[model samples]
Target: MNKLKNKVMLRGALSMLLLAGLGFHSFAQKKNWQNLDLQKDSVFGIDTEKAYEELLKGKKSAPVLVGVLDGGVDINHEDLKRVIWVNKKEKAGNGKDDDKNGYIDDVNGWNFLGSAKGSVSHEALELTRILRRDKAKFENVTAAIVKPADSAAFNQYLKAKIDFEKQTDEAKNAVANIGGLKTVLDSMVKKMGKEKPELADFQNFKAESSIEDRLKRIMVSQLQNSTFEAFYSSQIVKGLEHYQDQLDYNLNPDFDPRPELVGDNYADSQQRNYGSNDVKGPDASHGTHVSGIIAADRTNTIGIQGVADNVMIMGVRAVPDGDERDKDVANSIRYAVANGAKVLNMSFGKGYSWDKKAVDEAVKYAVSKDVLLVQAAGNDNKNLDVEKSFPDRRYEDGGVASSYIVVGASGPNDDKTLKADFSNYGKTTVDVFAPGVQIYSTVPDNKYEAYNGTSMASPVVAGLAALIRSYYPKLTAVQVKEIILKSVVKVNHNVDIEMEEGIAPKSVPFADLCITGGIVNAYEALKLAATYK
Candidate 1:
C-alpha cells in the first residue's frame, strides 16, 4: 500500500510539471490570439459576430433579460450602462418598497450580500463554516455515541474539518513560498538598478561571489520561460494578497464578516428582504466581466461587443469573495425569475452546500417559470462523473432539470490541446464547451481585461441562450436549451485533456468530455432555433 501511495504521489508531481509547462505556452498563445478579428476567429469562439452579420441581419429581436448572479456588477459601467435591467415598478431612493415585491429600491437589481450599513467581500469557506457550526455538537464524540439520525451529519463534519485543515496548511505554505520568491526577485531587480529587470540583464551581470553567482544563474533560468511584465505584474501580487486573506479570513472559523456587513440570518431561508440595494458592491470585477460577456452594447465601438445584442443584464449580487451561501443563491434565482429574467447566469460555485434543498426548490421554481439557467462546470479539472460539484443539474427527486445547462471551458486551438487544461468535464453532466481561456471582457471602472475560467464559459452560453430567446421568442426555456445542446460544432477527434494536476494527460474522445461532445457555435444555434418548430 505504501509503495502504491508513493507511486501515485510521483505521478501527481509529474502531472503538475506538465500542467505548468502547458500553462506557460497557453499564456503566450492568448497574448497572440487576442488581436484576431471577432467576426472570423475560428479558434473556439462561438462566431457571434459572423452570426449577426449573416444569419441575424435585418432580423428583429426582442429584448431578453439575463440575470447575472455573481459577486456584483457595475451597473454604471460605460459600455454596460445602457443595457442594464431597470425595475420600473420600484421607485429608487425611497424608504418604502414601492413595488411591494418584498425588496426596497431594487432599481438596478438586488444585492443579497449587502445590508443597510455595508456589504461583505470575504467570508468563511463552506468547509470552515460547516466545521465551526457543528464543532460543539460533534467534537470528541465517538461514532458509537452518534445516533442513527446524526451519523450523516457527524461524518460530514469530520470530512469538512479534515479538508479545512489541509487546505489551510496548503494556503499558508503557498503564501510563504510566493513571498520568498518575490523577495528574491525584488532584491535582484534592485541590484540591477532597474524596476523590471530582463533575463538578459541577469545573464550578463557579474556576480561578486559564488553564492551571488548561483542565485543569479537560478533567476536567469526561471526568467527565461516568462516575460518580465507578465511574471511580475500587480495581478500576481494581488493574487498573493488574496491567498493571505483566505488564510486570515476564510479559513479562520471564528471570522464571521456577515454580522458587521450583511446582518442577515444566514441560516434562515425564509427571510427574503434583509439585504441592501447596493448592486455594485465591494468588488464588481467578476460580475461586471460576466455581464459584459452576456450583454455589453454591441453598437458601441469603445469596447468589445457582447454575444447578444438585445439583452438587459439584470445584476443579482449574491456571491461574495468566498463561497456564496445557499440561502443567497436560492434568493438570487427566485429574484431573477420573479423579475422577468428569461436567462440566469451563475458563474460562481463551491464544493459544499448547506441548504441544497432550498436551492433545488428554487431551481424547480425557475424551471416552472420557463427560465433558462446556465452554470459553470467549475475549474477543478476533475471529471464530474466521479466527483460532485454544487449547483449541479440534478434535481432533488433524482431527475435532471431540463432548463439547466452546465458549461465547460475550451481553448482557442481545436487540436489536441483544444480542451482547457483547467476546465472540469463529465460525459454525462457537462452540456457543452465554449471559448473561455483568456476571454477579453469588461472589468470594473470601464476597464477591460482577459480572464480564463469555466466562469467565463458559463456566461458565453448564457449570452447565446439570450440570443436564441431574443430572436425566437416563441421557444420555451427547455426548447432553447435543447437547441443549444444539439446545435454544437462537434469535435470528432480524440483530444488530450488533463484529468488532475498530478495525473498523466488522458486521450479521451472529445465527445466524452461533455454530453454534446462539441463546442458551442452561436451561428449554428441561431440557425437551428429558426428551424425548430
Candidate 2:
C-alpha cells in the first residue's frame, strides 16, 4: 500500500510538472465535460445532443429496457420516476407474486438486498469474510497438512487474511486522524464565536504559544480562501464519515448486518427468493446516478438530459455498500434477462470472487437471451489484464463472453490527460473508454451531484447500447457490442498517462490502453449501426 501511495504521489507531481510546462492551469476544468458538444466545444463528450439533433431526428424507435445492477435506485426520483421500468405482469403493493415469477410484487424491479424489516447500509469486504470463514479450519495448518489439491484454496485464505489485517488497520488509523482534526476545527470555531468563520479570521487569529501557532497555521492552510463551514462540510465531515463507515462496517469481520434484515442463507446460492420488493434499499445514490445517466427525463427541463431517450431503467438492487456477493450478482443478471432487459449495466466490482462459475453461467444465460452486459473496468488504475476483477468477460473454460463489454474511464482533457488517472486499463481486458470523471447525474430525492469512477463510465456505454438497440431493433447483443467497439473515434496520438495514481506518468500509445484505442462516440455508433446488416 505504501508503494502504491508513493507511485500515486509521483504521478501527481509529474502531472503537475507537465501541466506547468504546457502553461495549462489544469488538465481539465471542473465542469460537466461529459455532456459537452464534441465538435463545437472540442470536449470529448459522446455527442448525445448532436446525435439527437442531426442523426436521430424524427426517427421512430421502441423503448429499450436497461437493467441497472447496483446499490438500489430511487425509483420515485423526480427526474427518474416516469422513466422507470414497471412490471406490467406483477401488480404493485400486492402480497403475492401476481406474475408467478418467484418474486412478489416487483413493481419497480426487485431488490436482492432488501427484506421485510429493512435493508443494510454496509457490509464486510469479501476478503474479510473469507478470512473469518476459514479461520478455524486453517488456523495452525501448514502446507504439510494440506493436500496438493487443496493447496490453492489454502494460499488464497492466507492472502485474504493478510489483506484483511492491513486494510482494517489503515482504515482505523484514518478514522482516528480525521476525528482528531474535526475536534480541533470544532474548538477553533467555538473560540471564534462563529459557525462559519472566514479565512480572514484564521489569518488574524493571535497565537499566544508555539502550540497555538502550529494549530493556527494548520487551520489557515486548510481553510485558505474558503469558509470554515464550507471546508468542514465538504472535506472533513465527509472524510470522517467515509473512514468511519469503513472501520465500523466494511473492515470489521465480526459484523454481519444481513442476518436479521435479509434472512436468506447467504452461503446457499440456491436460496434466491428471500429478498423483498423494495428496490430502493438503504443507499440508492449510486444506482440512481447511473440510471439518470441512462434515461433521465429529457424534455422535463428539470435536471440533466440522459443519453438515450426511449429507454426504461430497471432497478436490480444487488450490490451493497461494500463488496457484492457473486450469488446476488448472478441472480441479478438472471432476473434481468428473464424479465426482458435488453441491456444490463453493472457498475460494481471487487477484487475477489468466490463463485465465479455461477456468474459465468449467468453471463451465458444473458448471452443466450441476447442481453448486452456492460461492466466497469475498476478504478484501481492497474492493468486489468494482469490483476483480476470480478464479473469479467472470461469464463471458467478459458472462453470469453462475446456479449460482454468492459469500459474504462476517460477524462475531459485531450491528448496527454485523456484517460482518467484512476481508471484501470488494458489492451486485452478493457474494450473502450468513455467520459467518467465529474459526471453530473441525478441522486436520491430529486437532487444531482457529480461522482467519478469507472462505475460511471460503464453506464454511458450501456445507454449507447440501449440507443442502438432501440433504433436498430434487429441487431443482436453481440452485434451491438461489436458496433460499439468498431465505431470508436480513434485517438491517433501518443499520450502521457498515469497507469496508477502516485506513480510517475508514462508515455504510451493512447491506442494501447483499450482494445478499441478510441473513446466511445454516440454519433459514430449510431451511424455505424444504421449500416449494419
Candidate 3:
C-alpha cells in the first residue's frame, strides 16, 4: 500500500534505473544533515544540536516514556540498550503473568502478532481481504441491477477489486523489469571484465541495441548516486524481493496466516487476551530504525544521537508486513498508555480500514490519559483532503482527536524539493513537516542506514515531543502539540508539489501543503516551550 510507501519505493528504484542522473552530495559529508540547523547549513532541519547547546546546556531533564507502535524494535542494539524501556515490576521469561496485565512477562511491550509457537511475518493486504470476503456476493452483480440496500457494500467491493487488480499488475511488471535489468547488469559485468565498473566504462560505450542502451542508462544512474557495485548488490536484490513478497503474500487472497500463526479469534474485536510478550518479532528493521530516531542513547556517542536524551523507548509490536488489524492497534495504544507512556509514535498507516471504531476509541483513550499521539501523513503524494489515509486524527464519529499531531516529510534543502515528492499533504490534515529524506538512523543488528518515507518523519516529531515533555514535566499533551505546531519555521515562498504520480507538478505556496506552512524546528520549539510553563 502507499501508506507503507512500498509501491512508491519500488517505482523509485525502477525510475532511478531508467534515468541518467548526477550526484549532488558526497556520502562522506552527509553524516547527519537532518539534524543540522537551516541557518547554518542552508537546509531545513530541526536544529537539534542548537537546542541542546544553546538552551539545554546544564539543565537536568526528567525521564519520559515514549512508545513506538510499529513492527518491532531491537531493544538490544548498542546505542539503544540503555535507553530501552524496561518493566521493572515484571521479571523476564517467568512463564507467568508477572504484572497481572493479562500478558505474561510484560517486560518490553506486547506483540499482538505472536502466538505460543511463532509470530506472523507476512499477511494479505486489507484490499485482498475485502476481495476475498465479498467476491462471492458481488463478483457477478452488475452496477445497473444493484439495489440501494447493498449500494455501499457493492461500491466498496468494486473499488477494492479495481485497486487489487492495478496493484498486482504493477507488481508483476516491476518484477519483469527488474529481472531484465539484472540480466543486463550481469552481462555488462562479464563483458567489461571488471569487478567494479566506472562511469566512463559504460556511459562512454557505444550502444549496439535497445537493451544495451537500457543497460547504459541503468549504469549511469547507479554510478551517479553511488558506485555501480553498491547499487547492483543492494537495490536490485531488495527490489526483486519486495515485489515478490507483494505477489506471494500481500496481494494473494489465499495467504491468510492468522488462524495458524496468531491463534486468535479473527471475528472478535474486543478480545485482547491473545498475543505474547515477544517484543522483537521476526522483522524489526522499521521499528528499530524509528526507535533510534526517537531516543537512542546520546551519552553512548556511538551510532547516532537521537533527538531526545532523557526518554525511554517502549516497543509495542502491532504492525506487520501487511496491514495491521484494528484490534491490535487499539490494544497497543491502551497497553502503552496504561504502562505510563507520555507519547506514542504511530509510523504505520493503511489506505483501507477494516474496523475504525475500535481504533477511534483507542485514540480517545490515549487523549483521556494526556498522552500525545504522533502519526505519519503517508507517502502516496496525494492530497489528504481528498484521499483516504486511515488511522488519521479524525475520529469515526465527529471531530478530530486532541493531543494528536500529523507529520509530513521534508527534504534537506529548502528549495523546490523542500517537500518530499512522495509525502501526502493537505492544507489542514498535515500538522507539520520534518526531515525524512535520506534520514540516517539505526536498523537491526547494530547497523545504521538512511531510509525515506513519512515513517521516518513521524519519529522525528515524536522525538521532539518527548524532548519538550522531558524538560517541562508539567506540560499537558495538548500543550506540547500546540507548541510544536506554533514554533515551526514558516516558509513564505511559493513551492512546487506533485499531488499524484505521473501528473504535471503544480506550484503553490509552501504554506498550502500543511496548516503550519513550515517544518519542525526543535530550537525554536524549546525556546517557545519555556514560555508555556
Candidate 4:
C-alpha cells in the first residue's frame, strides 16, 4: 500500500512537470514571433521582417481610416501632415457646407467646442456643470422643495449637489491647511534661490540637525508643500466659481446648450447639420497624442511610429478637456462612419453622463456602420465592474449593444501583478490590458511625452486594431475584436499589481484581472489577421 501511494504521488508530479514545460515552450515561441525586438533598427514599433510578411499576405494595399476623438489634432505637425483625413466633399477655406453635413466646410473634421482656444479639464467641466445645475435650482427653490420630475434629472441633480458640497468642503479644508505649510516652503524656495531645486538640494535641507529639521524635511521632500499651496487656493476659488456656474448655466438636462451655440436642438444627433470643419480646435495636445499613437507617420526617422503604416487619421475634435457633451460624441461617430473611418479611438470618459440614451444610440449606430469603438476604461483606480463609467458597451439594460472594445492599462513586464495603479479593471467591463504606463507617444507642436493612464493603453490596442483591419478588412469589427482577444498570450507568473485604495497588496494571476488576460501584440494580431485572410 505504501509503494502504491508513493507511485501515485510520483506520477502526479511528473504530469505537472510535463504541462509546465509545454506551457513555457508555447509562451517562448509566441513572444519570439510577436515581440521580435525592433528597438535597434525600426523607428516604428513594427518588426520590419514581420511587416514584410504581412505585406506579402495582401495587407499592404488596404486604405483604412482611424478617427481620433480627443482635445484636437495639430494639422500642421510634420509627422501627421500627409496622413490627415481630408473631407473630400468640401473645398478648404470655402466657408460653405459642400457636403451639407451642417458643418461649414469641414475640410478635416468638426470642432464641437466653439472657437477652441483654451484648456478645459473634464473634471473642471463636470464640477462646473454639476454645480451650475444645482446652484440654479437651489436658488429658485429650497432643497426641501427641489424635486425634479424626471428621474434621471433628479438623480443627477442630487449627485451634483453632493459633489459640489464635498468639493467645496474639501477646497476649504485644503486652503486652511496650505497656509501653515506654505510658510516653510517659501523659506526653502528663497534659500535655494531657485523656483525648482534638485534632489540634492532637498537632501541638503534634510541634513540639518536643528529644532526645525522636521519642518524643513517635509518642505523639501514633497513638492506639494509649495505646489499644493498655490493650487489649493485656486481650487477653493474654482470650487466657489463652479458652484456659481452650476446656478448660472442651468445645467438642467431640460435646458440644452446647443441652441445657445448653434441655435439648434442638440438632443437630436440625427441633426448632423451642426459643427464647423475647423479640425485644429482650441487645444491640440490630447488629440494629437492619440493620433500619433494610431498613425503618426512611421519610418520617417522623426516622432514615434503610430500602430499601423497604411493608415489615415481622421481628426474629430468632439472631446474637449471638459466633459464631452453627448451631442458632440454622437455626431463625431456619425461623421467618422459617414466619412470612412474604420476605427474610432475615444481616450476620454466621465462619471456623469446626462444624455446616456443619445450616446448609446450613437454607439449602436457605429456598430451598424461596421466601425469599431476603442475606449479607455478610465483612470480612477477603481474596479469598473462595481463602479459605473460612461462610454461602455453594456448599458444598465442586459443587451449587448455595439462593437465597443474597452481597454485597461498594462505594463511591459510579463508579471501579472504590475498592472498600473490607476487602471480601472473588470472581467466584463474591461476587454484587455496593454502598455499604458509611461507610454512615449506624439504630442502637438512637434513634440512627444510619456504620459501614463488607461487613456494611453486604449490607443495601443486601437493601433493594433487598425493594423488588423488594414491587413484583414474582410474581418468584421466583431471578428477583429474576437481575434485580438483570443490571440493574447496569457502569462502564468505571479506579478505584484498595485491594488485599489485601502486594500492589502498581494499577487494574482494576470488572467484574473481583465477579460482578454493578455497584452496588445501587433505582430501576433497581424499574424492572426493574416490567417483570417
What's the lDDT for residue 302 in model 4? 81
lDDT per residue for candidate 3 within 296-380, as digits (tens), equals: 7899869998999999999998888888878889999999999999999998888888788999999999999999999999887
Evaluate residue 355 in candidate 1 and report its C-alpha lDDT on the 0 to 100 scale: 83
Give a tens-digit lDDT track for model 2, residues 1-533: 10011112122221232223211112234344665566788888988777898899999999999999988899899999999999999888768899999999988888887688888768877887787788887888898898788788799898888878887776676666656656665777678888788778878877665544665665576564445664566556666666677678777878888888888888887676878888888878889989988888887989888889999999998888788888889999999999999999998777777888889989999999999999988877888889888887899878989899999988886778788887889999999999987688999998997677788888899999999999999999999999999989898887666643356789888899999999998888899999989
Q: What is the TM-score of candidate 2?
A: 0.90
TM-score of 3: 0.95
- Model 1 agreement with the true structure over 1-533: per-residue lDDT tens digits: 00001111112221122224221332444332322323465456787777888899999999999999988899889999999999999888877799899999999899998788899887788888899889999998989889899998899898888888887876676577556556655676788898877888889777775545655665565577665666556324654676687798778888998877888887788778888889989888889988888888988778878889999998998888778888989999999999999999998777777888899989999999999999988877778999867887797678888899999988887788888877889999899998778788898999987777788888989999999999999999999999999988899888887654456888999999999999888888988898988
Clashes of each: 1, 8, 0, 13
Question: Which stretch of 10 consecutive residues in model 4 shows the poorest summed lDDT?
Answer: 1-10
Candidate 1 — worst ten consecutive residues by lDDT sum? 1-10
lDDT ranking, high to low: 3, 2, 1, 4
Note the Cα lDDT for every prediction shown: 0.80, 0.80, 0.85, 0.63
Winner by lDDT between candidate 4 and candidate 1: 1
Q: Model 3's lDDT to the true fold?
A: 0.85
Off by over 4 Å in 2: 1-32, 187-193, 198-231, 496-503
lDDT of 1: 0.80
Q: Candidate 1 or 3, higher TM-score?
A: 3
**Residue pair clashes in candidate 1:** 12-502
Comparing 2 and 3 on lDDT, the stronger one: 3
lDDT of 2 at 118: 88
Winner by TM-score: 3
